[model samples]
Target: MAENTAERIDWRQLWASGDLARFCFICLGILLHATNETMVATVMPAMVGDLSGVELVGWSLAVYEIGAIVAGAAAGRMTSYVALRTNMMGAALVYSAGALLCATAPSMPAFLAGRLVEGFGGGALVSLAFVSVERLFPQRIWPQLFGVISAVWGVAAFSGPLIGALMSEFLSWRWAFGVFAAGGVAAALACLAVLRGPAATRQRNDGAPLPPFPFATLACLAVSVVLIASAGVDVTPLRSSLLLAAGLFGIALFFGLDRRLPAGRLFPAKPLSLATPLGNGMIMVAAFSVATVTFTVYGPLLLTSLHGTSVLTTGYIIAAESIAWSVLSILVANTPPERERGIVLAGALMIAGGVAGFAYAVPAGNIPLILGCAILQGGGFGIAWPFVTRIIVTAAPAAERTVASSAVPTMQRIGYAVGAASCGIVANASGFAGGLSSQTAAGVAAWLFLAFLPLGVLGCLAAWRLPANSASPAPA
Candidate 1:
């Protein structure tokens, strides 16, 4: 089937159709966005030194994430009302403004403010990129497109640190932020060129607007606060208790919203529907959950701690995963959708194995082992993400596609925050290699935390629920 499509649409035809160019532009934007994220982690300390807001470092990242989270649904709703090109341009403008703010920040408070604003734009842009694929491309090519997107991350991981380091060393840490701003400008220009004209500015009327503050704003607020409290800085009993209470309140509110809202208005269709593919959902959760911990925190820490690897090396290591993920993604994209479940299940197992290997190999202090584990994990990630995404896209109705797609990144961010917090708590308690007499304890804890990959076996079960008898896509 894939062979037929490949033969029919040659590269020239694909390019001529505009899908290829659109993907390229969006991918390039995402690639730069990704690079900024990884690069900044390496040069963050320098920023702190210059800015003297070491305590607010967590807030900088956290606030950005918070802004991004809030903007996800908003973007979806806007897409329904506005033209794709207009929506993208607006987001780019917001992002550019935020970047400029970051570049000029004179204090912790100011920098944090910049992150919050940037998050608003960044979140929308990222999710919209995926939504664009659904809106602009053929269903048959999603897996391949997703792989290509994943590869951008790999490329970013490989190159971001070097760019960040060079800018930081020769220029200043401020240059990191400046570089991101420049990238945003470049992407905005590309978008303007490729997606221009008055027709590009009109909003479609395919569906109703999403509910105001869908999924309960309180719930999202709580989760954000708890995540920040947990990962950001020192936790006192009072602060922890407050955060816990807020998080609980948020969770309760979300469930209430889920139950009370109508189908068209709800964030998740049915939170407690037993008939839903529980196994697949859990596996998906695990795959993303592991990603949150490993990539969000542990991977970066590994570079800064044991090997004293520079920002450049850290980027390269992360790039290794990106490369593996992209390669596997392209391979799986060509496979029949019927085989997607089995492929995903196999990928889950591989991811688990790789994580386990990393844990065992870490104690030996072999860099090769770590790199191998990253590659393995990347492959697993490559497989699971697109398959699960395909499931959601194929299952949901066209009108509800944006809402459903929003869940992917929402869950990913939630998983990442939870994973990073959990790992941070454990790693802090266990301490680093040289700091402790028995590095085994911390290493064991670290591996155990990352080994969350095996739990994705449940996703295999979810794949079983995909209707086997029907060739048509699932109802929205």
Candidate 2:
């Protein structure tokens, strides 16, 4: 069968639609979040160089995602009462303010506060962007739309890391955050100008009234992440273990409560199980996402310490994955539905391979091998992500499409949040907190890089469960 209606959909019409301006802003919202993530990674080594809390390196990422998870959970519910344009405008402004806070932070603890705030605004922007896609665009081109969304990261890959590298290498890293802060403000202004009409200002009744916001469910996730993240920051083996166990319970409680929500449920039914299509797809995203944080949260420090790579070089090296992902997603956006299953399985294997390669290549200090693995890991995700997403949204119950769409990124962030905390624990245990000597750096490289390999295996196992029958498009 034809793939996701893209072959029959008009590519030009998407750009020509009257909604183009809204669409552009949507992309801008995505750009802010994507750039902020990679840019921070590029600048992290420098941030630590000038500051303390090397042991808390993972907390930087953890706090950001924690903020994101909260905002993302609330974003869908916000749409029931808040206008899309208004929600977006408020979110963009908040994002800018948070960046400004980060840019001026005086110490590590202070900087983390900024990251948390920035994450809230950025997360809402992204989740709202997905809701906007469904609300504004023709259903015919959803696959194509997702392909373009994937390309946004590639754009960020070039711009975000470069800005970060430049700031870290030449000027102060604070300048990088300053530039993005300005970008966020610009996006907020565009929302006012482009979405001016009375029709755009009102809440859109896209479907039946959504349920009341799931406060109990949201609390479970918040508590879970806090306990898990706190466990690693001051790592005593016994205390950390206890916290980790408590955090896992939070996740369990979240799943239990979220499942019971009548209409305002955070996910489709059976979100955690692999039996249902939505669950299986979410599992795949979560596993691979958890498996990949080594590069983002820890890649720069290890590269600089092990090989004497400049910040710019490390940024570019990590940026390679983004490049590959964008190219592959664009290249394969139209694969017939029949082939999607095989592609998913193959891509899962490739992702695991690249992650495994990192454990060896990082410790060995081989530049070519490291770059090659990065490309493989990125390309694997690019190749598989759209199809995985398509399977998910396509399989969603007609009434719950919005929830399913927003859940896509929310699920991915959950993986990153858990992964970041796990990284702090492993890295600290490996003696990185004592500061890295060449000998210790190599050992940390081995442990840190290998830590998430099991997540890769788990993702591959989930990939095997993807239905062989082709799924259909979601309701328009």
Candidate 3:
């Protein structure tokens, strides 16, 4: 047990190998997505000052999620027909174009369109990167590599706010996007130079054409998020209730349609059930994702409004979570296979505690407490997520590895969509829509974090139900 627990790899070997370029692209792919997301989110408060979008914030996020959902679903199958290099370059170019559009957008509607496109491209990049990990890296180092991926977000934690503030305060919020747009372009060029062949090179051995795109499934996902977002924008007794239900139904419909499809499926078999490890893992992912995102959608605004915090400070405060997530993930990266189940469950408990911590801390207007809560939340996910991901990937049918790997981020976005929409509804109903004030801010802050407590609990339960054994690591 000691030997297994203490075992370590020559981490430098990862970058020393011929696969280094592929790995760099993979990291770049995530950085492109994470940095854009973080920067935009950081600058949103200032952006709204230039544009009238106080109410449309939820919709803005939801549209991006819709685009991401569509892109994530199709990215897996695209590899069957297109080379990974080409697909990555195309996705990066799309991201660059979207960022360019946003940088130049004059109206809120145009901004929304730009965000949708960015999400589509970013989602594809991330999904493809996930697939690359399975294909390019040895399984034993997955935890370390996943830590590296989390570390990218940690870098984003600092870079996002610093750059976002520099542009939003010193220049223009639009220029911030212009810089990141250039990054997407650079990543695209890198992809062109580095990667080769298709993602699932082994899967297409039968030499058959892939199935048609699942347009209906994508549409269902889009509509569901729209309805939920609409409910958040206009909270009412009957209207909001109906919209929420319909939105959830749309998600269920998407799964049913996806399962029935002959190909181009988004998730593994029995995705909605709890009987299988994949199902539990999915539920845990969705639940925890739903539980945590309220911080993202509402955290900065609330902090600025309630506490008179600077926008830059608020951004970093939010970033504290990402940093903690990275630090803890890297610390726990060496966990042996035998310890995965316990660690996952422990992480889930910590996550639940973090949400509860936010419930108390955010409303109380304590910066230190809020930051602590964020660390708790992020740290929990950091320690557990790689293991949870490994569990899901291992439990997945051999043929569905690509789909399963990609599903992690897809599920996270779905959960974020739901969480963001729900936050809007809770905030609006708490009189935040009336306008920001001390009393209103307190109410919104309290409910926004509290409302998701059930989701945290659900996450814990789902984690508890996950399978005990993970796939054995390859020999070092």
Candidate 4:
């Protein structure tokens, strides 16, 4: 009992000893990346309207997500070759350039190119931020730091839509991109300042030569996303089916090849299985992400068509989950270790319930119910995410901690890409491709939400399987 008590974290003391300014700067990096994503999602409709690229709008998100996933996977190892400060500053610069390109893009193709570039930088920024948490802070403070980062995402959820809508409505959507570009610059400058001196030297000394890039896996993943995205376009059923099959096969190939690789691997061993703590946590993250992202990808469109909801209102509704998640995470960030399993289970239930509720709420055109469901879903993730993250990071071998930390976001982005594509398929098949009418939108909503319920169930099972015991450190 004495030994157990001694190991418990003292949050206050940890914070007191920490460098607040440097932590803030690290949080800022992630905030900028998160805000850019939400802002683009909000402003995309206006951009498409003005740019006359309704058909290419989905491609924008698809390309960005694919680029982000690839970059995130590579970032874990990339940091090994470069100093964290140098790497982060370069990524921020790239993000700024991409935002500038979007601000001035003359056509959809150009805009898509910009999005891809933006995603690469944004993805690296996020993954590197996670890695920084492991390298910079003590294990005891991990939950608090993760909570702070979640708070930043919540802020983005609240502000991103409002900022994007205001810019698009009162000024021009181009101004929104400009705003994000400015944020990138600020993040870059902050990284330059805070990540210097002894800390910078420590990071560089710990790093190693860059390993081989996962080119084959990257190619497979990229092609899969492309095929899945292409299937969403107005196409014959047979062609769409073939595209979907090809994409699934590509994904299988990626996993197969990834498992065969010895050292320079993209994911941890048994990444998709529930047999290990890291694998269970990652699989849960992926499954839950896939189930929940249906709302983000298609909720706004369906609600606008069926319920006559304004774009701004729909954005807030979609963001309700983030708000709930942030609030819940802060409330439980310091939960005693003994209660971690309970929280995980409760969070999983909330997510599954929320997903099930959305299936009915959207088609019924019930605004309050839809918002409630969103809150439930978001709250669930908030409760579970920190604990899962802690387990995965702590369980990894010291040498692979960066890779393990980065894999959480990598899995999440992969899940988002796949979920978005899956939703597109269901929507098109359910008469959404013809037009965005109330009836078609409702049909799509029903099919989309229902299809994802199985994923939610699988997520719950994974969460339940997580070991109650603190994960043992991997063999050195």
lDDT of 1 at 371: 76
lDDT of 2 by residue, 1-476 (tens): 55745367565765677565457767898899888987898898888877767788888888889888888778857876889889988999889988998889888888889899899999898888877777767676677677677668678876787779889999998988898789889998888778765545788666886667788887778778878877876678899999999999988888888888857776776776877777888999999988898788888888887888888987888788888887887788889999999998888998999999999988887888988999999999989998888888887877777678767877888889888888888888787768755665777898886778888998998888988755666454
Predictions: Cα RMSD each: 5.2, 3.4, 4.5, 4.1
Write the number of the candidate with greater TM-score, choosing between 1 and 3. Answer: 3
Lowest lDDT 10-mer window, candidate 3?
197-206
Q: Give the worst 10-residue stretch by lDDT in candidate 1.
A: 432-441
Superposed model 4: Cα runs more than 4 Å off: 1-19, 52-58, 76-86, 130-150, 189-210, 274-278, 334-338, 390-403, 437-439, 468-476
lDDT tens per residue, model 1, 300-330: 4444444455555555666677678778887
Clashing pairs for predicted structure model 3, backbone only: none
Q: Candidate 4's residue-wise lDDT over 55-94, tens digit each?
A: 4545666777887887777776766667778888888988
Cα lDDT computed for each candidate against the true fold: 0.62, 0.83, 0.79, 0.79
* Model 3 / residue 123 / CA error / Å: 1.8
Q: Which residue pairs in candidate 2 have backbone atoms (N, alpha carbon, C) closer than 3 angstroms, thus clashing? A: none
Q: What lDDT score is found at residue 432 in candidate 2?
A: 73
Estimate the TM-score of every prediction: 0.75, 0.90, 0.85, 0.84
TM-score (C-alpha) between model 4 and the true structure: 0.84
